[model samples]
Target: MNPVLKLTDVTRIHGEAPHEVLALRGISFEAHPGELVAVMGPSGSGKSTLLTIAGGLDRPTAGSVTVEGTDLAGLGQHGRARMRRTSIGYVFQGFNLIPALTAAENVALPRELDGVAPRRARAEARKALEEVGIADLADRFPDDMSGGQQQRVAIARAVVGERRLILADEPTGALDTETGEGILQLLRARCDAGAAGVLVTHEARHAAWADRVVFLRDGVVVDETGADRVDVLTGPGAR
Candidate 1:
């Protein structure tokens, strides 16, 4: 089967002329269905750049990004936006929920925008919230929930439909250790159930939830390790 997400020789450059900063350098990667890969790197190492490119939120400066065998470069802006709503799910450090909308409505918004009937979209949203262990909070607005609950709502929104690839960038940045672990568990479960997941985090313990870990340094992939051995590659003592 084709990989859920693939990046071939991708690069991203910001700025112009003498001040240009290379955000990524010929990075190549693939995340298959049922696999969760963690991307580890310090600031400016291209972790967030890679996620944005994969999710079609940003264009690559070179090479291509394929989602389930469909080359994103071939899609026009509208097409790419539709693809993002239907196939890619992104979770950011901040919960980007609409403050006035309840959790279920927030989760249902994307589906609704995609032309899914409001009734069905809301039903799917409820299921997603339940999957993330927050069904009881479905009727609550983001302001009414705790930080963890809000993040759970964010997760529900991301994975609400048949979204095949989930991209999380520092998703746990605001949560406490236990809440962060809960979020990781939800991501892991989603991957196990067939969606491909890429989690970008600097914490070794957070990366521990992934099946494989890809380490980046100065915008280049410096190491790749199986979950069992990620410590040797990312641990402070490792190099």
Candidate 2:
């Protein structure tokens, strides 16, 4: 199967030369439809950098990012925004929901921005919220909910419209263990249903939900292996 997301020799630098930091170095990566790749790394290891670049929220200083066959660099800002709304789903570490909108409205916003009718967007939002087991919280605003509920809303927003690529950064960080596992299961199911997923996580148990696990350190991939070998590679209970 073709890759839904691809990064070729990607590099990202922050700040000017004298004070700059390299967040990624010539990293090449790909995630195909029906695959969920977990990126495991310590702090400042570029796991989040790779995610932002892949989601088009940030551009690489050098090299390329392609999603569903479209070159992100070639799309320019508005084009990339369009692609993000229609084809890519991103779940940020911080719940980035608009405080004023309720869970359902926040989830529906993306589809509406993509030109879907308001009613249709609302319908899709309902389904997405239900999928995340938050249907009853549909009318609740972010500030009114618990952290776990808010995180569930974030997940619902990301998966709302049959998006082809899903990018999640520490998605379950705020949830309880059972809820976190449920969130992981939702992501696994989404990948199984033919979407490509990239999860940035540090937990081996969480990595077990992935089809493949990639280890990164100092802005470089140190190793990669199948999910079954994560405990061996990361060391049992390591992370």
Candidate 3:
């Protein structure tokens, strides 16, 4: 089966001249259907940079990124925006929900933005919420819910429309340990159900939930290994 997301020798450089910052360099990665790849790295290690480029939120300075075989660099601004709304899902560290929108409404926002009818978008939103085991919280606004509930709503929003590629950057950053594990379980389930997932995390325990782990340092892939070996790799003095 084709990988849902692929990055080939992707490099992202910000600014220019002597001040140029290399955020990513020759990073080739892929997340296939039914796989969850964890990206573990220190701050400024380019994990987030890789994710942003994969999601079409930023362009690569060289090489290419493809989601389901469509080269993101070839898509014009509007086309990339449409692809993001229709085929890619992003879960950020912050919930990023609209304050006035209820959980279901927030989950439905992407579909609606993609021009799906309101009623149908709402229906799909409910289904997404149910899948995340938060159906009853549908009508609750973000401010009215606890952090875990709000994050659940965020997950629902990300996966709402059968989006094949899910990119999560420190999604559990704000939650407690138990809540974070719960969130990881949800992501694992989604990947099990065939969505390609890339999770950027700093914790070894969290990376253990993934099928494999990719370690990044100074904007380059330093090491990669199966999840079973993540403990050895992430331990103190291991790098």
Candidate 4:
């Protein structure tokens, strides 16, 4: 089967000639259905830039990014926004939930924005919350929940619509180890159900949950290995 997300020779440059910095350089990557690929690297290595470009939140200065078969550049601004709502789900390291909105409402917000009826959107949101194992907290506001609970709401929102591609950047960064592992388990389950996933993480243990691991350095893919062999990148004295 074809990849749900593909980035081909993608390059992203910030600023202009005199002050520009390359955030990504001739990088190509893909995440196929039923797969979870983890991108790992040190600070300034372009992991987050790669994710934003793939999710259409940022455009590449060169090359192409395709999601669910549509090239992002060809989509234009509005088109890309539409695609983001219908086909892609992004989870940020910081939970970007609205404090005033309850868990269910926050999860439903995307579908509602997409023109789904309020009642139907709510039903779907609750379903997603249930899938994330937090249905009981549907009415709790972000401020009223624990960090783990709030993050669960974030995950529910991301997968609420059966989005074809899921992009997560340091999704477990804010939680305790146990809570973070729980979050990773949820992501793994989502990929097992067929939504392609790309996780950007710096922790080797977290990356181990993925099917494959990609190592980046200075905006380039320096190496890649199956999750089972991640030690190739993080083994003792391997760096």
Stretches of candidate 1 exceeding 4 Å from the true structure: 227-239
* Span of 10 residues, lowest total lDDT, candidate 4: 230-239
- The runs of at least 3 residues in candidate 2 whose Cα sits more than 4 Å from the true structure, single-residue gaps closed, are 227-239
In the predicted model 4, the residue pairs found to clash are none
| Candidate 1 colliding pairs | none
lDDT string, candidate 2, 209-232, tens digits: 999999898788788888453332
Comparing 2 and 3 on TM-score, the stronger one: 3
Where does candidate 3 stray beyond 4 Å?
227-239
List RMSD in Å for every model shown.
4.1, 4.6, 4.2, 4.2
lDDT of 4 by residue, 119-146 (tens): 9999999999999999999999999999
Q: Return the TM-score for each candidate structure.
A: 0.94, 0.92, 0.94, 0.94
lDDT of 1 by residue, 1-239 (tens): 57899888888899997999999888878888999999999998989999999999999998899998999999999989999999999999998999989999999999999999999999999999999999999999899999999999999999999798999999999999999999999999999999999999999999999999998987788888884533324232134
The all-Cα superposition gives candidate 2 an RMSD in Å to the true structure of 4.6
Clashing pairs in 3: none
lDDT of 3 at 135: 99
lDDT of 2 at 71: 99
Error of 3 at 74 (Å): 1.1
